[model samples]
Target: MKQARISTGTQDLPMRWWSDAKTPGAMIGGIVSNAFAAIGSNRQRSILTMLGIGIGVAAFIAIVTLSQGATDSFTSKLGFLAQTITVSRARNATNTSLTLSDRDVKILSQLQHVVAVSPTISDEAEVVFGKKHWSTTLSGVSFSYLQMQNVSIGSGAWWSSEEEQSRRHVVVLGTKVVENIFGQTGIDPIGQTVRIGAQLYHVIGVIEPDSLLGNDGIYVPYTAVYTPSKPNQIAQISIQVDGTDNLDTVQTEIQMRLGQLHHIATDGSGGFDVTEAIGQLKQTQQQLGMLSGFMSSIAVISLIVGGIGIMNIMLVSVTERTREIGLRSALGAPPSAIAVQFLLEALALSIISGGLGLGLGLLMGYGLSSLLNVSFIVNTSSFLIAFGVSTAIGVGFGLYPALRASRLDPIIALRSF
Candidate 1:
C-alpha cells in the first residue's frame, strides 16, 4: 500500500509543502496548536508530567518564601527589644559569677548620650492566686524600665517611685501571666493580691502582649522585692541613648565605665560586656538572612530536578514524533518550523506549570503562616525569578531535542516507520 501525503498547505505542486513560515505569529500558533494536539492525544501522561512540575515548583516557592517571611518577622521582633544601648551582666567564662549593680546603672546613666537607665533583677518565682500556682520569671524594675524597654501597660499603671522607695508590695503582670492566672475573665487584676514566693504583692498593672524579647514575666517595684542585705545589686542594666545616631558612642562609653568599675581589663575578653540594641538587631537580621539563603539553596535543588524532568520529557516527545517530523520535512516544511514547533510545546508546558506552581506555592505559604501565627509575605522578586528561570530551563533543555527533530533525514525517518 502507498502512503498518503499530508500537506499543511493547499496548493498542489511537484514538491509537497508542510507549511509556509512567512509570519512568525502563524508559525508560533501552529507550534502551540500542534503541542496542544499532542498533549490531547496523550491526556494521562501529559497531566501526570505537568502535575510533577507543578508540585516541585509549589514546594520550592512555599518553603523559600515562608522561610524568608519567618526571618523578617524575627528581625522585626528583635527591633522591639533594644534600639540603642543595652548593658547586661556578663557571665565569667572561667567562673559562674554574673552580676550588674544599681551603682553600675548610675554610672552608665552619667555617660554621654545616655538618656535613661533602668536596673532589672530577674528571678524565676512561683505566683499563687487562690489554689492555682504558676511559675513565672519575676523582674524587679523601676517605672523607667517600661519606657527604656519600650513596653506599655495594657491595664492599670506601672509602680511609682514612692512605691519603689518605700518597698511597697506592688506588681505588674505580663500578658501570659494574666492569661494563666485570670483565664480571659476580662476582670481587673489590679488591687488583687498575688503571692510571689513567700511575699504577698498587689497586682498594680498588666503589660500588653508583646512577643519581642520573649520576656513574658511579672514586673514589681525594684525595692519591693529587694533583699535588704544586697540593696544595690541588680541582674542587668538597660540604658537608652538620647538619639539613634548616638547609639555607638553611648555603648562604647558605657562599656568603658562598666569595665573600670568592675576593675577588669578593657580587652575584648572582660568581666563585663555591653551590647548596642541596634547591633544585636542587625546581627539577628544577618543570621536570619543566612537561614533564608540556606532554605533557598534547598529549593533550588528541587527546581533543578523539575527542570531535568522537563528536559527528559521534551527529549521523549521529539523521539515519539520522529515520523511526523520526517513527513513534514518531506512535504517541504523548513527545519526552523520543525524546531519552533517542538520548542513552543516545551515553552507552553513550562509556562503552564510555572503559573500553577506559583499560585499553589503562595496559597500554601499563606495557609501555613496563618496556621502557625507567623507572617505571610509574598516576595515579588522571588516569584518573578522562579518563573523566569523555569521558562529558561524549558528553552535551554528543549533545544537539543527540538534540533534533533528538525535535522532528521526524511527518507531515513520514513523507512523506520
Candidate 2:
C-alpha cells in the first residue's frame, strides 16, 4: 500500500488515474483490463494452454456420459420389473449351482407376498413349418410364465391349465418367429403344427411386443421341449411380488427359504442368487459413478498440466514486462494491483478454457448419448465441476507467479532493460 503512493511530484498515466479514484473499484477494474490486454497479446500460448484443459474436460465428460448410458440401457427395459425377483445359479469364480426343484417353486409361490413364480428353461431346436426350416430358441416354463412376465398374447392364448396338466405338446411363437416363418402376410399361426426337433408341437399363441415387458421369448411346456442335461441343473425362477412395499422382506424370505431347503450353511454366501431389478439398477448406478470418477480423474490431470503451463507463462510475462512493471510501480500502482493483475490473467485464461472444454464436453456427451441410445444429461453439476476446477487451478497455480510479479524491485526491474 505504501509503495503504491504517488511521489507527490509526478503525474503519470496510472498515478493520475489512481489519485482521483474514490473507491477500490477503479483499481480492480484497471487490473482486470490489464489482465485481458496481456492475455490477448499472447494469443497462441494462451490458446495452447487452453487446449490442454479443454481436451481433458471433453474426454472426462465423454467417458462418464457413455458409461452412464450403458448402465441406463441395462436398466431401462427392466426398470418397471423392479417388483420382481429372480433366483438363479450363482455366477462367481467358485461356480456355485442352484438346484431349484418343484418344491422350491411351490414354496416361493406359497409365500404371502408372492404373486406368481415362473420357472424358465431354455434349449435350441430346429423348427420346420411346411419346409420353412429355421433354428430358434425354445423357452420352457410353467403356465404362469406370461402372467408373471406381464407379456401379452398377440393371437390365440397361453395354453389352458388342462393342456399343461396333460403334458400336451403346446408352444408359443414370438412375433418375430411369426413374421419370419409365415412371411408376415398376417397369417394366423394358431392351431398350426410346427416340428420342433423330432416332434411336432401345436402353436397355441404368439407373443406380442410390449415395450414395458420387453420381448417375450418363444415359449413351450417344460415337459414338451426342454429337458435338463445335467442331473440337477434346474433353470431360473422368476418371482413376482404381490406389492412393492415388502419387496425387501420378500427377497429376504426367499433367500432364507432357499438356503434352508438347499441345506446350505447360513454362515456363507447362498448357493442361489436372488436378483432384483432395483437392486441391480442401484448397483449399476454406483459402479458407473465410481467408474466415472476414476476415469474423469485421469482426464482431469491434464487440467493440472494446463495450470502449470499458465504459471510458467505468467512468470515469463513478468520477466518480459519487467520495465513496464517498474514504471507502473514508480507511478504508484499498488503491489496488490500487480498481484491481482497477474492472478486475473490466469483466471481469465482458465475461464475461457473451461468454457471451451464445457462446450466440447457437451458435444461429446451428446454424441455418446446418441450413439448409445440413452438420455443426454448436461446439468448444473457439469458446469460447476468444470468452472470450479478452472477457478481452483487459477488460484493454485497463479499464486506464486503473482507474488513474484508484485514483489519485483522497481529499480532492479527498471535496470533490467
Candidate 3:
C-alpha cells in the first residue's frame, strides 16, 4: 500500500498543473493554438472577414495621404503669392481701359499691411547701345518695383529716389539683355548710354539672372514714360503686403477704397480685379479637406460593415464548436479560457488584416501622388489610428459571441453535439 501511494502521488499532478497554469506564456500559447485551429476550420469565412477589414483600413489611409499630397503641392508652388496682391485693369461703363493713376498708388502705399505699391507699364521696343541694338520687352517702373519683385542688382545700383523723382532717363538691364546687346563684352554695361525708342537712357544697374525678367528683362524709370496727357498713368499695380494672415482684409480695404476713388458702385462694375495667389491656395486647401472628409465617411461605413461581418462569423463559430467547447469544459477548462479563445480569434483576424491594409494603403497613396505629380506624404498617425480602431472593432464585436460560448452549460452543449 505504501509503494502504490508513492507511485501514484498527487504531488506530481499538482506541480504539473501549477506550472502549466501559472506560466502565462504556456497558457497563452495553448489558447492561441486552439483559436488558430478553430479559425483554420473555416478558412473561407475568416478570409472574408479579414478582407473586409483590410479594404476599410486601406481606404482610410489612402484618402488622408492623397489629400495632404495635393494640398502641399498647391501651397508650395504658390509660396511667394502669399505676400503679393495683384491689381489689374477692368473696364467700367465710362472708360474702355481702366488705369491706376499716381494718386491711386500714393493712397495704396499708405494702407495698413501694404509694404509698397509698384506702378508699372509694359511695352515691346528696340534698345540700342552705341553700334549694337537688341529688341526686348521694356518695363517702366518705380525704384520700389525692384523691391516688390525681390530683385537684386548684380552690378552697379538701382535708381536712387532722387533719380526716380526727377524723371531721369535711367535704365536697368537684365543679364540676358546685356548679353544680347554687349555680346560677351569685356566691360560692364553700367554707366553706358542706351537708346530706348527715341530717348537715350543711361544704364544705371544690371540685375543678375535672379530678377523677375530672368535672362530677358529690362527696366526703366516709371516717370520716364509720363507724358503731358498721361503723366501718372500705369497699366498694372502690384501691392506687396506684409504677410498672408490678413490678406482678405487688405483686399477688401483696397477694393472699397478703389471703388470709391473711381466712383464705381459696389453692387456692380468695380473697375479693377484684385487677385492673390494665397487666396487660391486657401481655396485649394479647403476643397481638399472637404474631399478627404467625404471619402473618410465612406471608409468608416466600410469599417462598420467589416466589424458586423466579424460578429456574425464569430457567432457561427461559437455555435459550430459547441461539442469541442463542452469537452474542454468537462475536462476542467474554465469559462474565462473559453471566452478568451474566441476573443483571440477575432483580434488576430483584425490585427493581421490591419497590417495588410496599411501596406496596401501606403502603396496606393504613393501611386496616386505620382500619377497626379504631387509630393508623397506618409502619415504615421493614420497607421496607428487604423490599427487602434480595428482592434477596438474586433473586441467590441467579438465580445457578445464570446460571452455566449462561455455561458453554455456543458451538459446542454454535449447533448446538442
Predicted model with the maximum lDDT: 3
Clashes of each: 0, 0, 0
Candidate 2, clashing residue pairs? Answer: none
Cα-based lDDT for every prediction:
0.72, 0.75, 0.79
Model 3 segments beyond 4 Å from truth?
1-20, 86-238, 245-280
Give the TM-score (vs. native) of candidate 3.
0.62
Cα deviation of 165 in candidate 1 (Å)?
A: 4.1
Least well predicted 10-residue stretch by lDDT in candidate 2: 5-14
Better of 2 and 3 by TM-score: 2
Candidate 3 lDDT by residue in tens digits, 314-399: 99888877876676677677899889988998988888888898889889999999998888998778878999989998998999
Off by over 4 Å in 1: 1-22, 93-99, 184-187, 213-216, 231-233, 259-269
* Candidate 1: residue 262 Cα off by (Å): 4.2
Error of 3 at 364 (Å): 0.4
Q: Rank the candidates by TM-score, best first.
A: 1, 2, 3
Estimate the TM-score of every prediction: 0.86, 0.76, 0.62
332 Cα displacement, candidate 2 (Å): 1.1
Task: Report how far residue 55 has shifted in candidate 1, in Å.
Answer: 2.1
